[model samples]
Target chain A: MTAVVPPAPPARLCPSLAAVYRAQLSRARGARIPLLFVATFQSIGIMVLMRGVVDGGDGDEARAVVAGSAVLVVAFVALNLLAQYFGQLRATGGLDHYATLPVPAAAVALGTAAAYASFTVPGVVVTAVCGALLYQLPMGGLWVLLAVVPLAGAALAGLGAALGLLAPRPELATLCGQLGMSAALLLGVLPEARLPEPVRWLRDLLPSTYGVDALATALEPGPDWGSVAADLAVCAGVGVAALALATWAYRRAALR
Target chain B: MASSIARPWPGLAAPEHTPDGTASAPAAFTVRGLTKTYPARRLKRSRTAAEPAAPASDRITLDVARGEIFGLLGPNGAGKTTLVKQLTGLLRPDSGAITLLGHDLVRHPRRAARLLAYLGQESTALDELTVALAAETTARLRGLDAGAARRERDAVIEELGLGPIASRPLKRLSGGERRLACVAAALTGSRPVLVLDEPTAGMDPVARRAVWAAVDRRRALDGTTVVLVTHNVIEAETVLDRVAVLDAGRVIACDTPDGLKALVGTEVRLDLVWRGEPPLAVREIAALRHLAAVAGRRWTLRLPPDRARAVVAAVTQGPAFAALDDFTLATPSLEDVYLALGGRGEGLVRS
Candidate 1:
């Protein structure tokens, strides 16, 4: 007689998350390579262009420019690409697959976000290092990116996922993603001192701004560790809230 | 095992779900009073009725036995897919109770996911993965260990004859091949219930046989319960142990194929394929035109068995035989049952 082992119960959150992460990582590795390259080069190109207008390594404008450009790489992949990814996923009925699985909704959303975020590591690191050299900023505190990349990636990926899942149509989701990346560029890449009060207030609302602020604070010869921690904490909070919203959006889309 | 529900409809045996209900044993699934309506939406804002959209599933109730193949046969827009989705816990009903394998599915959709393996009608999921990987991942996702997952994946791939395309991405496969890959994935884990919505939609006859054979193997070996949603009346007649025919979002008839067919009485249908237009016999035309439905080169006529024999002999042995390419006199089919039950054949294509 053939042995018929019954199916086990639905996987718990951790194992499900790990399985989803591995699958997404393997699937996206090849597809996202060229895009990650573009993201990295785009950040470098912006930093070089800003180098013409804003002249030196030791100034506050230089710090903002380098930091903002570095975090912009994270925004490109985690927010823009991830948004398009989820939008296409929802449009193509991909969410139905996850909804049918025994995995938790959080696992599906978080695993995808983590996979897209993973692509940004090389881009963010390379951009930070190259921007430091081009803008003549101190590279001493560049270690701050170890914290900044994930925090910002999480916050932005969650927002991207939410936009894709909540949008009624895939084209609208793509538009939302582009608008989001543009906001990151205008608010994050520009020096805070040069912005109008209202626009600066808008800058405070963008999740990547906290990442840029934390990185800029770390670029000083002697970094303000307390300010950096506070900024990192806010990014972490936004990341969590946004991810939760994404999970909710996923449920809404899947259940429909 | 058997199950029952309270609400009673004509043309079906009283469903037994509770103490007051009629089922005698344990059932794999019990759905009661399931109703879902899509709310009306206005893209441009107009004064429309405050009424909701037509109900997609209107008070569907059924009990699927533990190991039998139960088919959901319907015309398009008959709410078959909606009912299937509700049964699989992918869509929630506005009001009703669904109990699958002793779990309250409406209350716990995640548990439903664990207990059921579903192959949707049209899926682009797992399009990034190769056929082998899609099957393997599904096994793993269903909580199989690595060894078992791999074993099941290999078994399903070979069973489906997908070895040639196993390495290719689902996105790169033909529509039928992609659907086959999805079937392979859905069959990996030995879940108690399998919900297949048009599993053989894009498949050729050979592939359709493979898909059904794989499902039959699961049913025989593992005693799996299958809830199939299909518009293929022929397949439904040949394979379904029991079937529910739906029209306009309601179950028009539910019974064993024979039981439903019995509703059509002793009538038989004669189908004729003509090499050219039907013969221009005025007498034959006057006698049969009102009862027969003629569409170009094909003609269908329903009558008593004795009259069917006479008509068959008349068509085959006479001058009319010269115009006939083929002819079949068959007993009432599930489609005939639907027709007898007041279905207009709007969405149920008779293959």
Candidate 2:
């Protein structure tokens, strides 16, 4: 037998968040492309359908239609798909892989959420631009999406992650993800004025509604930048709270 | 119950004991009074439990010497997995002390990865990752820098002969290939201890041999301590330095393989296949009266080695030979030790 030469043990406590993020990003890219396309096309298709009923491109109705569709892309990939991802990981005993690692529970959850949220970017941008052109809305104010995409994506992705981790079964997680996206669609995409009084109260509770509202106000002529900032501020606050909730959910599930 | 457990193990030492002249040596791992119970859940009205749920892991204790390759062998629901899970810090024991390398694991479960790496029995987390990436990622997760991670990944790929499918995702590989990749991935880092559950579960004979070769080399060169959970008794006999036979969440016996088999003591195993239902006259043979039914149309028995020839002759050439289909005569194995310990074939789990 050869003399023993043990491999040196690791000195660091856990893997860096960036390292985990990069790895998760690469792992998800191939599987999520088709779904990313579905999100983009679904938003564009919805916008096209609404174009027939709403005539004036400069009206509030058109702005609501365009902005709501754009944010819907974020809901699909970040909210729906991220839920499915984590739920499936839980069901397949995949959590064992992470639980055994020295990595913190936060790194695993946030890193995965960030990767799934990143997939929504291209889809969100395309829908926003296509909606702008289809509605003949002013393109100058469309830049608010820089703020809208991340805030909305963060908010939805966090909720998706929490739902997946908290759900007792993978099927229940999928159902929750679907239900959340449907709420985003009906409550976020519809004009607030058109909703029932009680339903509008629910619209206020959803984080994505603030994103839709911010984008809608920005698409108008001489828009009130104050309202957009307030909406976005609420979004940023909700994002922090939601992400914190997600981190808690990850710890609970990992321990279980 | 035809059990030899009453005879006691010939030689079983605690982890604190040294085999050499030294009297006191630190153990690599130690477990004392480990127990975990599952809570009874609400069931359908038609299926109420007749009794409270049994503890998944009953009070158990063992010690693993430094650099030892220990094996846990048993039938289904033997608590092997639950025990391993607690050791890896994946499952929390209800109460016990799990000491690994001087750290109190029960109180500081997160520190488990400090000295141990665990490979679970089933997982799909790495299915999306390529073979090289799986190893590279695990290395990175263990706190290796990107450059060192790559070097470690490359070394493992070469060691495991995974160059052909280095870029292939685990899901794209065959069952054996996927299992091999998972092993390579889980064992990539320099952790001192490894907890492998059924490491060669889906492997072919050649792949199985390759896996053991790698594990054996690690033990020989790195002096790594390994705790393996497996049902493959043949592999356990050849590779494990020590074996623990568990039944119903408890260790019935623990000793060196040779020491445990010695308890069988000169007994020869006889496996017989039936030509048809034996004549009543043939069935009355004293040896056939105590047959342990193995499976459909086959039975096995153990007797004194000297009597094996007479029993063989009676079943193969005498008037009873007309009723016998086939027979195999062999020496006792570690599995015989398990059965001789009163194991009644998958009777542990309260299904």
Q: lDDT of each model, Cα atoms only?
A: 0.83, 0.80
Query: After aligning candidate 1 to the native by TM-score, how far in Å is the CA of A88 from where it should be?
Result: 3.4
For candidate 1, what is the DockQ-based docking class? Answer: acceptable
Q: Can you tell me which runs of candidate 1 are displaced by over 4 Å?
A: A1-8, A219-226, B1-25, B42-44, B48-52, B273-281, B312-329, B349-351
Misplaced by over 4 Å in model 2 are: A1-15, B1-25, B44-50, B279-294, B346-351
Query: How many backbone clashes does every candidate have?
Result: 10, 0
> Residue-wise lDDT of candidate 1 within B6-121, one digit each (tens)?
21222223333455453343466778888998777755665665666788888888877767789999888888888988888888789998888767879976677888899886
Root-mean-square deviation of Cα positions for candidate 1 versus the true structure, in angstroms: 5.3
Candidate 1 lDDT at B226 equals 88
- DockQ of each model vs. true complex: 0.34, 0.40
- How large is the interface RMSD of candidate 1? 8.6
Error at B127, model 1, angstroms = 1.5
